[model samples]
Target: MSEHGFWSRFLLPGGLWLFLLFVVPICLVLALSFGYTDDLGRAVYAFRLDNYADAFDPLYIPVLLRSIGYALATAAICLLLGYPIAYYIARYGGRHKHLLIAMLVIPFFVNYLVRTYAWVALLADEGLLNSLLGDVGISEIQFVNTPYAVIGGLVYGYLVFMILPIYASLERMDGSLIEACQ
Candidate 1:
């Protein structure tokens, strides 16, 4: 397709969407980050560097760093675990791939917090894991309210988000690559 045609069709709609939502919001955040709030907690028209300076304060920096670290860890975990399942569903699970993908998506129909809490309940002490553990003489494993539980819940709940993208990429991938790789 010609560049003009491509832009007019694809980029036009996408650009409008990004401008209206993403770009505007990000610009607003950037603008607000340089301004101070009034007594009513509303942003004032006066411009200053205090907010940006405060963002780097020792009290907040550690937590900010931790969040970045955890997000990176989550990304790595998602890629490692989601790749194989995506490759499998896309390549081997032919004919029912759509149905299988749909099944994965069913969990999304539930609220995110609810899904996380469901895992919370399932992994809690005396919950599913402990009940199953009792069958093997190992009892009382704490899961809920811990970092382990949070990570597990995050991975389980968002697995579909990671999987769907990888799955789509794999599905659209040409089959000859598999033979080439093998």
Candidate 2:
């Protein structure tokens, strides 16, 4: 097959699919952001800069900074924790790689809200972990409604996202380079 024909046959459809799913929705949101809402909450489309102006107001500045800091911290944590696990799976998880990946992915099959509530159950003061610790004569520590709990939940929720890409890259890496280092 000709190069252009192959691209048109395969790549064009994929590109069109991405454009329809992502680009169209993003453009709609961009256009709607410049709109105003009526008393009934119906969107009235217009060209206005007030929304953008309000986004930078002093009241929101701290919130914006906090969000940026949180995002950076989350990304850093995900990378730090995910890269090693992915690398280990790619390099050392030979026969059981499929099972390992299945275990990682199975949680996603459950509802997100259910999984989050499950975390709450596991982290609550009277939760499973705390109860087990108490059984061994350890004092109970509060894990719920704390910064540690919040960060732990966020990390647990997003770690899979970080793992998949790192795993893909490691799996595709040349084994010869690793062997040469030995």
lDDT of each: 0.83, 0.90
Question: Which 10-residue window in model 1 sums to the lowest lDDT?
Answer: 145-154
Stretches of model 2 off by over 4 angstroms after superposition: 1-16, 133-140
Per-model TM values vs. the true structure = 0.79, 0.84
Tens digits of lDDT, candidate 1, 47-98: 7888778889999999898778767777778888999989889888879888
Off by over 4 Å in 1: 1-18, 125-128, 131-137
Cα lDDT of candidate 2 equals 0.90
132: Cα error in model 2, Å: 3.7
Alpha-carbon RMSD to native, per candidate: 3.5, 2.6
C-alpha lDDT of residue 21 in model 1: 97
